[model samples]
Structures are given as structure tokens and as C-alpha cells.
Target: MSDTHLLICGNSFNDVDRDRLSTAYPAVYVDAPADMAALESGLRASMRAVAFKGHTPFGAEAMDLFPQLGLIANYGVGYDAIDVGAASARGIAVTNTPDVLSDDVADLAVALMITQARTMIRGHAHVASGRWATEGEIPLNRKVSGSTVGIVGLGRIGREIADRLAAFKMDIHYTSRSEKETPGWTYHNDVVSLAGAVDFLVVALVGGPDTKGQVSREAIAALGPRGVVVNISRGSTIDEGALLDALEAGNIAGAALDVFENEPNPDPRFLKLSNVVLQPHQGSGTVETRTAMAELQLANVAAFLEGRDLLTQVN
Candidate 1:
């Protein structure tokens, strides 16, 4: 059998990173979980690590294929797709690329907020369709600056978003597991109260079961008709049904979403809404940030293989 010890799974990994991993280790590449069975025949028993990058579920059933596997280094900060509990039970380790992508994700969140508030998409369409020649101007839109904004989950990315918004002189509010030491920002114990207190709500929470549906129907209602929602975090963080119903009924003014519950192909209902701006989960897709994430992922894998401490261990 070959001495391949690293199995790089998922199609999301760029060619540059794939080549780098191949050069650095005895690696085998497979596109996704469905293709794993076919590749299993050739994989060496020495496989000890997986450089995972896709959204497919990697549970105990999948892990059972490789008896020697010890580490799963994830390319993205969010590892919801991987069952860390199962990894732990098997005496395996898990690592993710965190702080490296925080700035980029936060920048996208702020951009989404501004885009939705100013109706930037519609304005571009109006100009492109030559309506600007016929109509005097696009209808006046909501201003983002000087607005009251609430940030949910003030971790690394959340703090970055809040800091950027502060430059616009907006009032910032946040909810976290514990209160922070920011005297200028308001703190809310719950998401519902945070929603009620702000003109815009930006979600920057982590993904996983703990955060699932944290933004409830009541929180959506609290935002009222004039409020806008911006989410750069995981889609499961919000109640999708409530958000869809609210958008349809104009309960909130609009939403700008980077992630979705069912991504790449989100619910068809979202595509029909004119008040919404949808993105295909590209918050950290910039060339610089993606390269950094890939480097960090590889660094963690190398650390585990070389008997060194992991750069960003989650489990």
C-alpha cells in the first residue's frame, strides 16, 4: 500500500492549496463524501488526517472508514458540517481557521447592511435599464450612517463589524454569552431585546446546535417594519421560516444574507423577494482571506503531524 497519510476531501479547496498539500505530504484527493467509497479501495491504512473543506456531513459513519485517522483540519472557521463529538469519542482532534478570516467576513456584513439599506442593487438596475433617463431619480432610500445597529455574538468577527459601524457614528448594541467592556455600546441579555433596540441587526454568531434558531419569530417581529437585518454568519442562526414570513408581510424593511440554511441552493421563496439581497455564502471568499484560511488549515494539519501544538484547535 502507498504511504498516503493525508486525505484532502471536498471540492471547495482551490487548486493552489491542493497542490501545496500534495507537495507537503503523501496526500490523496477526493471530491466529496459520495466519492469516498470509490477512493476507499486505494487509500492506505496510514491515513491519519483529513483536510476537509465542504459542507457535507462527516459523521461517525464516515470516520469509521479510516481506523488510523487522528485529525480533521477544516478550511473554514465554521465546522458545523463535521461532528466534533464523534471525533472526540474516537480520540481524534479538530482544528479550524478562525481569526484569519474575521476581518473579511465582518467587512462583508457591513457591506450587506449598507447595500440593503441604500437599495444599492435597485439603483444599479435603474441605471443599467436606462430608467434613470426617464425617471428623475431612484426613490429615496434609508440611510445607514447614524443608525442604531445591534450585533449578535460579539466574538472576533462580531467585534470587527461593530468597530467598522462605529466609524459611521452609529449606535452599537450587542448580545454575547457575557457582557464586554465597551462603554459606548449597549448590551442586551437576549436577542429579542437587541432586535427591538436597533434599526439594523447584524448576525455574526458561530454555527452549531447551540446557535440554531437563536433569532426567533419574536425577535424578527421586534425589528418592526422599518428595521433591516444583515447576516454574515451561518443561516441556521436565524429562524428561516420566520424571516421568510416577515419579509413577505413587510414585518421588517429588508434583509441582506450571506449564508442560508440550505446554501448553494437556498429556499426558492428567498429569490422571489424584492426586499432581500441574497449572497451565496461568500463572506470570506476574497482572494487574500481565502489564501490565508488555506495556509492556516495546512499549518494546523502540519502541526498535528509533526508533534507540535495545533494553531487553532476546536476539539
Candidate 2:
């Protein structure tokens, strides 16, 4: 067998696979804690292939440094951080774990929507801070049941969220470039109109230059005072400053966010707001989901070695 080369940028697989990769391929394991800078030297040494996770960016500039790279498979559904366009231009195949994390991320989106709608965080804090009874009855919140729900993107996770909300009898509407006939749900051609019409707005759009800051101030303003916003997609999809302005000015009721613009470091203003809920971009964090993702990455690597097209091609 001809020697195949691979580089692992994150620690997802077990120790056995790490050892196996070294012997089977022209492999390199990046063990450093620092960002992509720390991995530059190791990635430069290998010419045949590479696999990475976390903040090891492979943009146009980064990809230019490695001419021999045949494939790049990410460990998560969203490959926003990676420059897929650049890789495509270079004739490299890029893949991500899509179906594996759809359900998990959908679940988180639904939960965050309910949390914000019901004011669950404020309720928990009231009791924990020992002011439950003395607070003169906590504020009332809009019920999630029977609300008009709008989704920004109607892709995998967006469709899943629509399916789950059916049990609540929610009036569901979604936005996409094209129209799709989803049972019991309506599709909106205009995202701003969808935002205006729905009582709850959930963001499920992908992140890239095309979708970056797509949810503008006008969209948020259209949602108005009684509506609540939930984002389970990339943070760049929404204008963070616009969202904060809406929440602070009571233009919208509240927000629940699972992703941030510059991940690992959300705006500090988000932490100080009582009308919003935040998570550290953990849409697909379940053990089962993560294992499935790792397995897909393995399959992608195996396919690349055998001169086969990627099973889950991105582009």
C-alpha cells in the first residue's frame, strides 16, 4: 500500500486510533494547547493529508501553505470557521458532520426557545437568591404553546425544529431562498416579513460570508416588543450589537443564544443582560452525537485514502 499522510488537529478519537494513524499514514498529531499558530510547524511538515478540530483554521491563506492536502473533514456540523470556498478553489474536498448533530442541535434550540419564552432563568435566580417570596411575584411571560414561530433557515436542523414544535400546535413559518412544502408549516420568501409576522423567531441559518449578519436591525425591529428570539445557529448570522440594542430597548421581549459571533468569547454585554439566555456554542454536545461525528470523520479519512469521493461533500 502506498503511504497515506494525515494530521489530527484535535483530540476526539481514542488513544488507539492516534497510535494506529501514526503507523498507517504519514501522520502528525497536534498536542499543543495554543491556537493555529502552535500547529503551523507540525502541519507544515506533513504534505499528504490533515484532519483537525477546534480553532485550527484552514482559510485561503492557511490552505496555501499546504499544497498536498487532499481533504479536510471537520468534527462538527458547522464548518463556518473553515474557509470551504478557499478549499474548493484549491480543488480540495471539504466535509462536515451534518446529520449526526441535527437532532441534538434541534433539541437545544427548542429548549432555549422555551426557556426564554417562560423566563426560566429569572425564575431560577429568584429562588436561588432567596428572594422568591419577597420579590412580589415574578413577571409574567408569554407562553410558548400556540405561538407563531418563525425559522430563519429551513435546512436540516431548522426542519427538525419545525417537526418538534408541531406537538405544541405552534404556527410555524420558515424562510429560505426557495419554497418547500413542510406539512403544517408555511414558508416565507422574505426573512424580514417572517420576523414581523411571528411571535417567536428562531435562527437556524448557516454561517458564511453570504449569511453573515443576515439578521439585521430591521429584522429584529420587525419582531417587535412581545416577540422572543432564539439562535442555535452561528453567532454571525445575527448582528450581536443589534440584538443587544433590541433587548435593552425592549424592542423585543428577550433572547436565548447558543452561539456567538466570535466564539469562545461572546460579548460581555450579553452576560449583564437579564432578558437573554446564553450558552457556549454547544448545539451538539451529547456523547452519542460526538461519537457519531468522530466516526463520520473516520469514514471521510478512509474514503480519501481509497481515492473515493467524500460521502458528505460540502459546497
Candidate 3:
């Protein structure tokens, strides 16, 4: 295959994604980790970098398949799916497409907040189905302006969401790894306290073992009956069962979710809940942002091939 040193792993890559990357630098392609083993021995040994584009885990076993592999350029901001520790142990560099998609994800977080609070989806259905004409005016929805909001993580995406909310006259509160210098915003020592203090709770924590279930059952309980929870971060960041129990029992006002523990197959219970708003994890799915992300991923691969530092190396 032209002695190509690059390997692109992505079962999800469409014709456009494949063509765009393949055209930039000729490379071998594999849909999944298992398929990598099927490559010719010479071709496998020549691979110096991998451009990974899916949620599939790339562990040490997979890394071993490429003896000369030096880098793994992840397609998205979150690399929880890849075993970074395994890559590091094998001296493989890891890079992710960050800042490029932050604005899109952050914008989606804000959109979910507004959509949930205002019942915009229901309003659309009400109008489209002619219910507004027959049943009279739709019921009033909650106001987001001037509301108190608590962000679970004050990282890049979280900060963006908070900044936009500031324009809505929101009182922003957040709990981060370390408190930031933003003077007007309140900082909480823990999530329970943060949840109890706000009318809406937005989760923006990264996905990994360190943050797994950071938003605990107690935290969910603390949000109270009037609290609306919004999660745009990884699903594993929160306790799914606890959140569902709280929602079903009306322990919390409602929830607006863009990610789930099971992803495309989230709990069937969520499908039946009218109080919750659900999205198909399209936080960074915009054409402009996705194009930027792809370009960033390719840039990292190119850097590794050319003996240059990765633009956004994770490890």
C-alpha cells in the first residue's frame, strides 16, 4: 500500500472523512481493532501513526499490532475511550482535537438548557399538531434569565457555557479541580453544595476513571425538586440510575441530556419521560466545527510523521 506509515482507524468514517484524510496522506484503513491484525506483516510494521476516529478502545494489545507506531491522534476532545496509560507505557504519543470543538459543544449545552427550561420541543409539537389551536394556549414554561446555575466542571467547555449564561444575567457557580480567578462567580467545595445552591445544574466534567460518578446519588438528591440537570459531558460522569430514579419520582424538576452511559441505546426509561429533554450526542456535530476537528486530527498525524510536536498532545 505505497509503503504508507499512517493507519486510520474508524468504522464510522464516511466517504468524505475517508477521502479527506486519505487524500492528505495516503494510509491504510481499518474499521476496528480486530481488523488491524489482518494487515500484511510489512504493512503493519511500517505504520508510525494512527488517526483514530471512533469511540472504540485502543488499548496496549491494539498498539502492539504496530511495532513502529509512535502516535495516536484522537478525533474528538474526549479520549476516554483510548487507554492513554497503555499508550504511554508503550512510548506512544496521544493527541486530541480540543479547542476547535469547544464552542460548538458549549453552544449545544446552552441550547439544551433553553430548550428544556422553555419546553421548546413541546411547543413545536403543540403547534405542528394543531393542539395550540384546539386546546388553547400552551402552558407556561420556566424562565432561564436571571436564574442561578451551577456547573459541575469549570474546564474549557464549562467556562464557555458559563460565559454565555452570564449574558442571560445568570448567577454562575462552579466546582472545578482548582478554583479559578473569576471573582463574581461562586465556587463550591463539592457537588452536593453546588447542586443545592442552584436552580439548574450543568455537568461539564471530563470522562475517565477519576471523574466516574462524580455526580453521585447524593448530589442528585441535593438538586432538590426545583432543580433541572443538564449534562453535555460524558455519561459516565454522572450516576445514571440515580438521575433516572430522581426524575421518575420527581425528586428533581427535570433533566436535559446530550450524552448517556449507554449512548445510542440509552435507558428506555428516558424515552418515556416528558419532563426530560434528550439529544443524540450531537454537541460538536456542526459542519464547521466538525471540519475544524478533522483538520486538527490530520494536523496532529502530520506533525508526528514529520517529527514535530503535536498541536494538542494529551500525553
What are the Cα lDDT values of the candidates? 0.91, 0.81, 0.92
Candidate 1 stretches greater than 4 Å from native: 40-44
lDDT by residue (tens digit), candidate 3, 1-315: 646988989887767777778898879899987788899988998899998987777788889988999999899999998899999999999999988898999898998999999999999999999999899987898999999999999999999999999999999999999999998999999999999999999999999889999999999999999999999999999999999999999999999999999978999999999998999999999889888988899899888888887899998
RMSD in angstroms, candidate 3? 1.0
Worst 10 residues of 3 by lDDT: 12-21
Higher TM-score: candidate 2 or 3?
Answer: 3
Task: List the RMSD of every prediction in angstroms.
Answer: 1.3, 3.2, 1.0
Any runs in candidate 2 off by more than 4 Å, and if so which?
A: 1-4, 10-26, 31-46, 133-137
User: If the candidates were sorted by their lDDT against the true structure, best first, what order would they fall in?
Assistant: 3, 1, 2
**Number of the top lDDT candidate:** 3
lDDT value for model 1? 0.91
**lDDT value for model 2:** 0.81
Comparing 1 with 3 on TM-score, the higher-scoring candidate is 3
Error of 1 at 271 (Å): 1.3
Please provide TM-scores, in order, for all candidate models, with all chains considered together: 0.97, 0.89, 0.98
